[model samples]
Target: MSDSSGMPMTFTTGQMTSLYSLAWTPSTTGGYAGTCIFLIVLAALSRLLLAYRHLIEQKWHDRAMNRRYIMVSGQNETDRERRIIGGGGEKAEEAVLTSKGLDERVKVVRSARSNVQGIPWRLSTDLPRAGLFTLNAGLAYLLMLAVMTLNVGYFLSVLAGLFVGELAVGRYAGIDDNHH
Candidate 1:
């Protein structure tokens, strides 16, 4: 079996193989091993990035909860009464437990937001999260491309990398599969 270029269209354990691009072909045993190692490291790094993203999310959640507490405590009796009346009493209490209180709390959080070196607080937190997401996405796509090569060695390398990555960082990333 062959393609238009006459290259065999089948999986092989041959040393000569192209990965991601023709220029990346590893034509020697050492080169192939290095490529496998690179893929392993790339997979591991993606997991590490995922763990960092989880940590950032946890941190932001904590901060948001703290801000909610501050808003609740900072409100005067009149403000609380007005909120209960304006939002409806039982609904207001539920709102305090949930999302509806966000609007009223914004003013207080804004002060803390502004105190952060003149940078908009949302931007400061959002940019890193967005950047990490973009990077993780790119890495994931690259790994997918590596798997698409159909070479048994490369495929096994990817699986091994994922296994090693999960063993190293899955717990910290909160990727609990067995409820443990």
Candidate 2:
């Protein structure tokens, strides 16, 4: 096909079916080889940028607090009540009280749980934050799929991108820390 400038466009399907080669067109001249290399490098850099953005999003979510409340009932009520009252005084007592008073005390818990056991309990409150991570996860998966195409150029590009991205943001994102 001819483009607006009347230069012919050539399309070729590579031998590898699994490899969904990127739709990059090299300039129709002796410099085509250089143009192809440039495009590959650009794609690699773009992948790195995407990874960096994902890391940034994760860091932001970690720092931002999305306030929510969880109701504690059943056998744990009395224990929770005592803990709240012990630390919070009259305000905590008043906060836990329902219209029926102490007989129906419902402990209001903060959304952010410190450990794994609290995940199920905090699902409702944590959904919004989870949604943010979901987007980052989706991008990561897409990058993985691209890598799976098994095109040597693209595969190397993705690997290099990941290595560079990790080096750039690993410490800032706390990925290098043992505690996390």
Candidate 3:
């Protein structure tokens, strides 16, 4: 039955069929878009945290440096005045800074990050270097696969890579199997 004419009916379509979707609809796009957005936001938050940490560290360093400047300048001015006033015994009042035996072992460790420039090459130079290359390459390939795959596959691959890499490292460095 028709509305009023009662014989036959023709339907009219609306213009806003696609526009019915929310302009900022995220939920409709399924998992990929939502997951990617979440990962992006996570990465951004982590980066911002790192930057804030760096800023705080730099602020502390700056404060320490400023204090050092005051102490150093004051000591210099004192020595200068002492020399101008005392004739010969100024050496008795010589300023000595407390360095506290900074052994630079920390520098050696931190330099690992900076001095990683020729790292692959350095690994090549080690004895039984093929093992190092294999270990490094295996770690890298697994890391790449991890970034691309589903969770279970990534976890399995990482485990396998770790075993292989550890075996290679131990063999190359002459460590017994029990060492690890």
Candidate 4:
């Protein structure tokens, strides 16, 4: 079916109300709940994409640094690496040396790495705090949808809840810049 917004309607406020007693739809509601969910998913994806961009750039920079180091300082570090890998061509000794050298390199790699995933990034970094702030602002939005869906008489409370819930979620996600 088509909605007032000129979009193909799915399960709508009316359809939903028909299914559940004491529910109704109005022109003001405007299918906000479903759209809000989509928006949340979009926000999550945006965060992931941004994290990936940073990680990819970091990897590229690291590769360049490593190559430059190998070309410019290879000989200088050779004496130290002798006991680690391929040092003096003693196969076993060289293997040990190589492993040890890699261990040191691993530290550098770790230092350059960052938490790109959501759970960690949200919990430990500023990203979630920022998200939280946005979510807070969204609270009124959700309440309006839910209220409009429920056809509850208290419009103001419904609006407040909607905004509060949205803002709370954003704050909890720690995506708000003002939060920190």
Best by lDDT: 1
Worst 10 residues of 2 by lDDT: 11-20
Give me candidate 3's TM-score against the actual structure: 0.25
Question: What lDDT tens digits, residue by residue, belong to model 3 across residues 1-180?
Answer: 235833223322221112112352233444434434433443333333333434444454443333211122323444532111222223323433235642221111111232324233333234434554455455444344333333332334344544544443323332222221
Task: Kindly list the per-residue Cα lDDT of model 2 for residues 1-180, writing each as its tens digit.
Answer: 547954324432232323223353333433444433443454445444445555655554543333334355675655543222224445553355445665434555444655445444345436645775566566566556545544454455556655665565444444332210
Which of the two, 1 or 2, has more TM-score? Answer: 1
> TM-score for each prediction?
0.65, 0.39, 0.25, 0.26
> Which wins on lDDT, candidate 2 or candidate 4?
2
Q: How many backbone clashes does every candidate have? A: 0, 0, 0, 35
Candidate scoring better on lDDT of 3 and 4? 4
Q: lDDT of candidate 4 vs native?
A: 0.36
Segments of candidate 2 deviating more than 4 angstroms: 1-114, 118-125, 174-180
TM for candidate 4 is 0.26
Query: What lDDT would candidate 2 get against the real structure?
Result: 0.46
